[model samples]
Target: MPQHRALLIGASNYDMRGIHSLPFIPGDLARLGSALRRRGFKDVQVLSQLEGGKQLGANFIKGCVAGFLRRAGRGDTLVIVLSGHGVHAAGRDYLVPEDIHEDTHPFESGCVPIDWGRDLDETPADHVVFLIDACREGIEVASMSVAGVTQWGRQKTDAALRRKVAYVYGCSPAQLSLYVRDHEAVTDGVQCGTVPGESFSIFSRAISDVVTSHQGALALDVFREAVQERVSLLHQAYRKRGNPQLLRTITDIPHNAFTFLPAAAGRHEAATPPVTEYPATPSRSTSPWWSTPASPPSGLRPQPALTRTAEEDRLIPPAPSHSAAPGRGQAAGPVGLPPRLRGSSPGPRHLISRRRVLLGLAGTVLTGVGFTAWKVIDASTPDRQLWKFNTREFVQSSPAVAGGVVYVGSGDGKLYAVDAATGEEHWSFATGEWDASSPSDSAVKSSPAVADGVVYVGSQNKKLYAVDAATGKKRWSFATGGEVYSSPAVAGGVVYVGSRDEKLYAVDAATGDERWSFATGDRVDSSPTVTKGVVYVGSSNDKLYAVDAATGDERWSFATDFHVESSPTVADGVVYIGSYDAHLYAVKT
Candidate 1:
């Protein structure tokens, strides 16, 4: 019997600096993958960030995806599911890699370009489907700032291979996909959310529900119509927006690949009543559909793992980063800030009185000022920045230097390694690309700590990471239950850091494995000072803790009336830290 193959990628946590993580994705895969397996795809392989701590989508083409494609011959089938962030640049759309740094290479690097192969003839199979539950359209949220959601297109999709290639986008590049609570007004078809009734991304859940409930051989065209209606109805029910169309897939041939392999067992035996409460509508395609026998043969049931017959190839290795900062000899513009996010707070407000504005500009204090606006710079200050490196966003992070290179994190979701002298980028690491963390939560805030050919840092995405100091390659990363604003202190082959999830973690520096953890009452954003056998840090729970480095056991804690975000320092036997309560304490070790 002919068989089917699938490569599923679910990136629940992103490392991109400004983007957020999608914790609901593991549910997406477990639900979808389980259903597909039951539908008879024996070769369903998955790469999920939530389950196994792996990268997905962006960099997979060279690593695992290509291998799977090459091993697939003429009649073999391929289905790919990408669930994560997507960005557009230079007239093209791309899926971000686990480590995408748009600040470093917005066009080509740190991304996966979507297109039919340059040589369609060289492709492994003609039947390929890409069901992407990502924003092809840019995102817009009143309270959030998203960095890389814009789409740029230079050429139309390939019409020659229309029948062989299909793309399903969750939402267009013009808007964001929201995770909403059931607006009872919305259709009751299927609402997806991490909190069950809340935080649902209606798009992904609809596809999963349709896949599970379809009665017979699922035709691509029919699936498209159902999605269009469901999404359309959803928009109508709640004053919402968005259209999920089959858009660029399907042919005049109607059913496309859904009806391609009728004789193949377990492929599309029958369109039994789908596993949903909503009534299933008859398909709109004119192409023939298949159905399983009233009682699929007595012997047919979910099968156990079978010996593989097809050769499984591996993805090609990626070439070294070509976007590294140009050598000093090259001429380049000064580093620029990322574009400001849309709908951000308005820039400096204007003062009403010209005299007050003049005084404000002159840095002279007026009795009441009585002005709503004021610039930070005084008239005495230079009007122009001396070759400023515009990051296009807030540069709250401190800078670190080594080997004439300056390393810094940005609100735009990048850790830029730039030439100290010229301000040209040498390389950058996108957070979500590796195990570093999601860019969501003002993601990369901790400063880089470079040591022993490695760079270590923390992110609001709740992870601590160690990357190659020279190449930006990820060495290892460890996740915490909450946001990690705590900087890591390395000593004795261990990495110590804290998280908002109220725990301090001691992980192996080399393997990125957690050795031990000590829980605090609240969040821990305080960087630790490790010396001797004790680690000193502060927590939002209004306390400072001294923990044993090796055992993760607390030795003692000092309480204050207010929270403590300040790190601790030690000299001799005295330990000192400041508290939000407006007091500084020096405790004896």
Candidate 2:
């Protein structure tokens, strides 16, 4: 029989003055322990200074981690969780311990390096999982200037018998995981005064919610996805409520459908059966009922299909004229969702729209608009039409003009470059072949950025492609962990872009190599603007960040009342940006 073992370490208090005490870490540790035990993890060991009353040093953590791994053998699964101040120094990641101080370097003392797979590969466990709830920045400590963990990704080489490995980070690599002051609002069945100042990191609360809400086994990938989405939406809610704190998760795990927990009754899962064996991957013949799509709840009709083109392709919905209010008879929340999970629907900025595409063609002195149909109008006389070009699907991406050519992306997964003077197609580049079932699959919604004879654009296929502007041929493609919905901004030999993975990446423009990445608290659909050694960008976390162009280190951040997807415009040392909160801001650069 397979066994499941877990080691949970929470370093709430720190010896260094710069590291703030996480008063809520103890509660988080207790909550996770109870949750895991009810899910068949009987042997759960928790180590923390606040709860266990023991000082955790680098050596102590190492010993405990080694012992935990050694206890597990073949057919077993091991889970390790670290909730503390995490630091990145000298090109390596470390977890700070209770005894860690500002005086010493991590190499000599105070921290434990996070090279888990080094020992993990030698372990006999069939699967290993790591859940880290910690800040990725060590820069808060006056002594440490560099910060952030390495982004999680599994390499091809691994032990053959180890079926899977998973890493779920509380926030993306350089982003901060926030401790919520209003924890009760997020979780169910919480005593008001239990653990005074009771709180939990946004990531931890989301995990607990997902675990307790289900009645059956919870798959790891599903757990990760649900937690990420919940945290994102929750952060948005927080922003609206005047709280600047927000968080989102990053993971390297794939959707192999591995069950991480066996369900029990009630939200607390108070009563649980003794574990006999770990849950195995269900075979297709005996798949769980939830594996298949469920019918819509009774009385609800299917979502109406959008009007389509002659080719049977769905047209992008027109932009909303104004903020949509809940219609009559509907509660004051998003129309389609249940009341428990409902909130105000985001404005047009949140949803991808086709009407936002527009560009100016200098060669013909025309203004091109992609409002349902691609049309060119004389620049001098707005009423005079010049020419029109039709695409198989809605033109969703704004066009780019360069060297007397106009390039635009469509929902049909193609990027077309046309002659500016005549609107004749110069060349068409297909990002990906269309799928009948998912017409928007691999859609090229990101606007194109032309620089140095290369046209850089992002596709829903999780790649940022650099195409030859003259020939329209693919030059290089950089793959991200999530869809590349943000447009590319090129400057100083680097291509800066954001991805749904919650990270803004800086890639070497000529070589397609990664220079650095800065993780935001949520997805980074905001295109970056580089000027004067600083890169200014916005995030779904409702903040505008100014980061060092060379180091990716955050210089400062300004919070807004809503998500900031608007690309920053810099002039006269001031950055102008907009937010969904119905406000425009101008900040000194």
Best by lDDT: 2
lDDT of 2 by residue, 102-157 (tens): 76754324587766555776787766777878663332654565444432111122
* lDDT, candidate 1, 471-575, per-residue tens: 999898788887676788899988888887889999898899989999997778789989899999998777999999999988999987556888899999999
* Residue 468 C-alpha lDDT in model 2: 94
Residue 114 lDDT, candidate 2, scale 0-100: 64
Q: Which 10 residues in a row give candidate 2 its minimum summed lDDT?
A: 328-337
Tell me the lDDT of candidate 2.
0.63
C-alpha TM-score for every candidate:
0.40, 0.45
- Score candidate 1 by lDDT: 0.56
How far residue 489's Cα lies from its native spot in candidate 2, in Å, is 25
